[model samples]
Target chain A: MSRRVRDRKRLEGYLPPEGVPISFSIASIGARFGAQVLDIALTYGFIILLVYAMVTTGALPIEAMFALIMLCVFLIRVPYYILAELVWNGRTVGKRIVGIRVINAEGRRLTPHQIVARNLMKEVELFTPVTMVFTVDAMSGLGVLLTLVWVLAVLIVPLANRRRQRLGDMVAGTIVVDNPRNVLLPDLALSLPAQGSVPHVFDFLPAHLDIYGRFELQTLEKVLRDPVRGEEPPDFGQISRTIIRKIGYADPVRPGQERAFLNAFYRAQREHLETLRLFGNRREDKFHSAPGS
Target chain B: MTDAVAEQDKRRTGSSPDSPAAPAPQGELLRSARFRVEREGHWRRLDELVVRAEKAGPASLSYDETRELATTYRQAMNSLSVARDISLDRALLDYLETLCARAYLVVYAPQESIGGLTGRLLSIGIPQAVRRSALPLLIGFLAMVLGAVAGYVLFTGDPGWFYTFVPPDLADMRTPEASVDYLRSTIYGNDFDAAETLAAFSSYLFSHNTRIAILIFSLGIFLALPSFALTFYNGLVLGAFFGMFAVKGLGYDVFAWLSIHGVTELAAICIACAGGARLGLAVLLPGQRTRRDALREQAHDAVKLVILAALMLVAAAFIEGFLRQLVQDPKMRLAIGWGIGALWLAWLLLAGRSDEKQANEARGGSAP
Candidate 1:
């Protein structure tokens, strides 16, 4: 099974070194909605604070103050949303707290125009309907009906999709992903033999570690992790042989010792990179690093 | 058995001594032990640095530590790929993915400044985007005109059609049942307090029209159905009013009243609808790209158009509230309307293009 996955990876060598495609987990709708609500609350809170500051200090007349507050609710809302997303790399304070982020579905850097378009659409999606609801006397029945249709349509769109992208996300080529979490587990935990044997039994040159970098090291971590996990222990003999050849090891790997061989390589490579890293030299990739310091 | 197949079978069973299947192979175990002995330390060191960086921001690291962190990250990345090819542990693989994601965010994600963002959007971005989205814009404009023509025919042929087009509250004092004097009074407002009244009136108009245009732009996602209906209904109301005034022999009076702001207001509405239609078509047709991709591409233009239209609506509102009431003569109103309309057209179509041309020429001239 592992052999087949290896062959497939080699066939698609032009792809990124990790070989597997990275896909973001779509954020939950509840989280997304919560973030939006928080964002709106924050915006209102700021507006109230500003109004209070202005009024107490007698900075402007009451009529002008009233107009300014009204103006902020309407005109400044879109600018606020757009500016927040733009400055924070598609994160608003609300989103950051909720652990969700907006990203271009195309996997490229999001442009300013995309950000503006989506936030501007929020007027129809969220603000206008909300305004209509508040100003019931001012809005005609027809206007209210249209606002409902507009808001409902925008809301239903994301719910209808597997990706949970809102209307703005669809139009702007963006998706909200659950912000990735990194939990740092000790590196050599696996190297400690389960049977109480000494883990520090193997020894090799720094050059053995040089053959692999972070990309390969990560793949090694997965391979080592899989064996003790699932119901079926996958066959790794062909894969082990291939790695031994690739790394140019002279000794022939024993039949059952494939997993251990790979795990050892993982440990050695990780340690070598970290030690080299302690010095000034940086190895960005296989070709672009200072010669052994 | 062939050596590779034998190796493969041994691997499939169990590597441990307690395994049900055959396993006792010293050479493979020895080879594995030898490899682990050499490179384990480097991998562990990299992992420790990654842990620290992940726990705090990359900023928590010293200058030397940060440099080490980057190197460790790259090495770990390469190791992941090798491990995958070699069929190593799966836990190690998942951990590396986590590490890479953390590192990528710090290294690759760009946090832009607010001033830079505003400057880019204001400069050539909005206009150039609009110019590219010609097809949807044309469709959106035509839908509004189509509604207008239909509205005129329906309302002129049947006066009751006004009820269908204009809601009672929106129609206000401009009903056909109202006397000519009442309609005239409605347009002129209280002359005693014209300045303050007109300011309030224009603000109302601007907000009203701006909201409508914004609604049309946003609702375009429903395959542009709402946008079409909205612009069409607006046109219908206007057409019905025109038909009513014409019947009352106050056609010129109504024309003067509307002309000052109507030209810019109508054009903006039409433009906004066009933007909406682009969004709809991208969804409905999607062309060569995926539906989402097409919407995204069209949205860039549609959004720019919406922004432009909203601004025009404001200008029109100002004219309608202030200038429309002040400019009594039909000829003068028409002149002002035409001048503003032409200026907008020139700006949308030519402003950015000419600027780009000059920039290109300057670059060419500067070249050796």
Candidate 2:
């Protein structure tokens, strides 16, 4: 059971100084890559727009315009990252959209110092090599080789670790985790009865209810929740018969009434297991003998 | 039916049927229905508030809403813990966990005003950090000095070393073989387009120096060797340039020209390297703490130092762009350079000592 749980979402555990253990679902690399692409696209598009606006204005000589573009690029892009992360609490515009946010690995409040440290690293990792390629030596073999090596190192550093932290994140001790907006679904145990139909009731003797346990109850709950099938509606009749025979249920479940019967059985079996759980005799599945046997 | 058969097949091969014996709950069953019925309203309200807060900010909430947010967050945290213990509803646990996590992030975010933060960073943060890492700062300066001496010696021995020390484009007309008059003209040259060029020059200097400072700080993570080498190389370039002028007997003039800006710029470089060296040292000698812990602790101070250095570089660029050309007199230039340097020194030594002492006391009696 624990192995199955662990294989679900990869969780990074954080033990705060106050000793509260919090686990975050690590954002997938694909999602992070997508966010970066969006951010880069937006930043470059904005820079191009600014340059184009200035050029059309015809306000200065070519040399001056060139200098102004350089200044704008530095001023706009660098702060767009550092300031945006600071103000939005570790989320960039792209990060917000993609549902991932950076947090301190220690689970402490994100500090401005950390924000600046990480973003400055972006310059070293990405921008400097790019600038070198364009301005220093556009076509030199050595320059291209150097850039390729640097880029590869930057790319591989994250893949080398389980945390998916790039060089900046490692230095600053931050990690990006999925920040999803989730809604509490209505309780399955209560929903069917509230559909304006008469509440279906099923009574089972202790021996009949004691045949199953939590594991089987959970599987039954899954069936009750998702009745998805192709071409036609789910054949609840077959499921109801198998379950009825397994428990040697006494009631006659009509073909159309199987769902209602199943719902009642789920409620009763859950209640039985929960009661047994309270009595220190919790059953895991039907294969296990009842406690005290 | 097919799914059920597959599940039965898996069950036969799954964990052995002998269920592990363990203590179970001793009280009434915490039915998911009852729990949801009682708490669903609060969860929905919290969900609404968190959504609004995420879209805008926490400040977007009214006073009552803010109070409600806090109360509801605590209540949600309680719900999460309770659900973890008693409820087997995976969906409920997942929802509550996410809710509490979101609320925790929102509620515990730093609440400092921008004005207070900026004042603090300037008045004490930079100076205190510089004071703390004095050894690294000294080492950084010494490395530069050694490199400068090396460059001077090599250039004096062979004039060709000047070309090797300085980039060809930057050397322009300032070579050792250039006429002394031409060397003087480049320094005092205020042509008709001086204003136009100065604007570009200042921007270039600011961007270039800031980039170098950032690079030096970043490379400090790798044992500080790279940072030391870069700083030393910068010093070599400076020393070689000065050697070229000294050979022409215009050493004082060139010294004045450089000191006007180099005093601040070079100090800025040293500070940046100091930040990097501090990072390297943390990795080398973590002492009692783990290397990661040391790096994190020292990085806070290092970042402040580097940021201060970057800001100082901007100031230096402005002085170099305008004042160096306008103040042609070597003596006045020296006075301004030393004046700025002295002010920086005074600021570093004394800026926020009293304030820091009080903060230290408030934190827990004596300073570390």
Candidate 3:
């Protein structure tokens, strides 16, 4: 097979397979819900406590205290989520334990800008006039009424979203996912060695297939291989060619420069693998380790 | 023998490369191994991988594999999650929007329902109860001090200002000779006509004093400066009047005459002023709370203190209008003034003790 055919086949592999369905179990949904609540509680709880302490101690007067508390709440909220996602790569302490993470609509890890955008929009979530009413009524008989309204707003988010995103999540271009327990086998293991480096190509899979399939493949590969090995492995060009040929692409280039092609293919594969390592590998203990599972 | 049989069974299961089942080993191994596919069209392979993972022990995936798989699994999970979330968002948004609109109507619209009004009123309870009561109490105390100071100053000063404030018919009665004649007549004659005339004059005095007090209290809205001015003017007038009578050697007699009703009446007016000042302060310096919020709080406090002041004013009116006339002797008036002042002070201090007692009872009852 020619290098051209192998490259085309690699590109073709990007398309989603037919009839591969996407679904979420009730349990998974519940887990996601639990994770969301936990994240909110952990992130916001400390700020609320701090404010309460300040007010109680008379270290801050009511007006100044409230302003400071709100500012702190706003500042801490988004950064908390962003840092957790970046460090844990999408999982908060709770999310990590529950084996779920947030990602963009395309099943990719969140960009830093995206994280900031989503987290900062928490201000929008809090932008209702009711908060003002509550503050105004704080010294009146109407305080209880305002408090009730505020509580209702806070509790309503998870119940309202299918994904259980509170108002903040809606503004953030992100979604939570259950970390798949299945392993992903590296592409090198799956690709045939006769073909040169696969061309850089884009593929649009059915959304579910892209998320679930990639997760499974990566998990499987990691399970089988020792990622810490020091020596370089054999060229994957021939395997790439074979896989391409099997996938039904025709060759365009002669096979005489197999060695040179193999070298290029290996280099590309290593780079791709490194990128995946940076963005992909999730810590198991963080999320998917359910009790008694 | 068991090994031989197992080997033969493996061969029969297409372990041989020539057999169709031979493809199953590679497929099974690939399937058993965990993998994440980032590229698009890998669904068939993904399905096969899923099948393999499922068939293999669930724990076949390594820790990293599990993390990678979790992402894909979550992606699939999110499809349903997103759909569910969208519907939930619509419902919540609708509910919140309705609430927001209702709040706006209650605050901005006049044609609100009684229930809505009540709700709005009730919302003020927490803030009023917690933070507002102080304004009225503080203002009331301050006003009393100011009124007292003014009264002392005026009564101890020259009586020139007294002539301006007292009606002409009443002014003629202030002369030293007439004052002595009137005192003798009141003691000796003790006639109904004299008593009636004195009662009428006292009524006028009571009404006039209460009106001035109310005016001073209400003027706080103009700002803190006005309140002080009104307070100071009342003080100056009182001082001048007192001073004139003292110079004339009639100061002790006048003090006795005034003390009976003056204590409660003056205290009540001062309380009213305090309440008004509190309201003004709320407007001037809202602090962290909004101006509206502060104003509402102060208004509540001021209203309570005003009610209490009105009650005190009524007490003072009764003493000045009727009781003073019944007692003709200066000595009797002095005794009555002290007695009434004591009673008023007792009432003020002890009026709310019952609430504390009730609260204690409730707490005790609930303790067990």
Q: Which candidate is the best by DockQ?
A: 2
| Model 1 residue B25 CA deviation in Å | 29
Candidate 1 or 3, higher TM-score? 1
Q: Is candidate 2 or candidate 3 better by DockQ?
A: 2
Docking class of 1: incorrect
Model 1 lDDT tens row, A166-273: 777777877777666655343342333322132223444555556666556655665555355446765677777877777677765666666666555565565455
The list of candidate 2 runs beyond 4 A from truth reads A1-7, A13-22, A59-67, A129-153, A193-262, A280-293, B1-30, B192-196, B359-368
Identify the superior model by DockQ, candidate 1 or candidate 3: 1
Cα lDDT tens digits, model 2, A173-235, are 888989866877655565543221444345666677868877788778767775556745556
On a 0 to 1 TM-score scale, where does candidate 1 land against the true structure? 0.64
Interface RMSD (Å) of model 2?
Answer: 9.6
lDDT of 1 at A244: 72
The lDDT values for all models are 0.67, 0.76, 0.45
| Candidate with better lDDT, 1 vs 3 | 1
Cα RMSD (Å) per model? 12.1, 7.7, 25.2
